[model samples]
Target: MTVVPPLTRMPHLRHVLAPVLAALLVATVIAVGPGSSPAAAQQAGSPPVVVRGGGWGHSVGMSQYGAFAQAKAGRSHGDILRHYYQGVNVGGANVPGEVRVGLLQNQPSILVRSSSRNGSQPSAPVKVNLGNGQIDVAWCGGCAPIDWAIAFEGGRWVLKDTSGAIRGEGGGPVTV
Candidate 1:
């Protein structure tokens, strides 16, 4: 029988009993608080930065519930990596995106963030990095638990309004 050494050997996940749990807890807190930027507050004319969190992504490395099939398939970490990172080559640790916010609930949500110089307006295309939460894929887009926008246009991502969220389905070709 083929034997896989272990799940996580990295110093970070060294002690699953502690480090991993701590990390998960941290992610949970961030997710449950208020997943919004200060700009969102300014837009609402609110003074204090609101705390937002509790996204479905688990706010951790990988959602245990989501990747169940992947693990069951006996795919090694390398295979899993390849499955997730289709176009990009995972050779070095030189990951892109400065990670303005590592709190993103997605996996490797890489995006070229462009910002206005004056800082008067919010950035365009929120550019989120969700793992398995796409409109077609993450059926819950309408009621998707998390609003961790990986990308936003003119300071928003979803096609709905600021207060307008999705309910059932959308994102397909519109017919007249």
Candidate 2:
């Protein structure tokens, strides 16, 4: 299904992946955060965040939905692939071996450890440096604080951010 070749699998995945992957994954849970800037670049007033579509990834290939559309329109696998991945002759070269399965949480555990009140959510999205801060993930003040209570569907630690925490899940502390 996932055409990601094998040469990329590894134990290194656990560490190298957590932070980087968490930062990247966290952006998906909401529409806009505190600021109004795109995530790529930040300014003095506000940081930016771009909302990507089609689940995730480049979305250049046979999107299952797209495939369904094409299939309904009577397109073959080759046609679907061609439509998504431009300029690539597909024959049969060599797809290395790589496939790993792990659970990824849909909601992040928000604690707001320090509660510093990071500022300035202008008329735009804010860019969080998220520097090498310790893994102190907690909900911040906003419409919906990061949902830290809900147990994920699979229990696998999701390496996402507070913004990307589970939808409609954030709120005041989860009282027992």
* lDDT at position 47, candidate 2: 27
Write candidate 2's Cα lDDT for 23-134 as tens digits.
3344333322222223222333442222222335533333567667887998765565555544534443221121111132233443332233464222332222222122
- Report lDDT (CA) for all predictions: 0.33, 0.35
Q: What TM-score does candidate 1 reach?
A: 0.20
Q: TM-scores, in order shown?
A: 0.20, 0.24
- Winner by TM-score: 2
User: Global lDDT for candidate 2?
Assistant: 0.35
Query: Residue-wise lDDT of candidate 1 within 103-156, one digit each (tens)?
Result: 333433222223334433333333322222333212222232322323333433
Best by lDDT: 2
lDDT of 1 at 78: 46
Cα error, residue 8 of model 2, in Å, equals: 26
**Candidate 2 backbone clash number:** 24
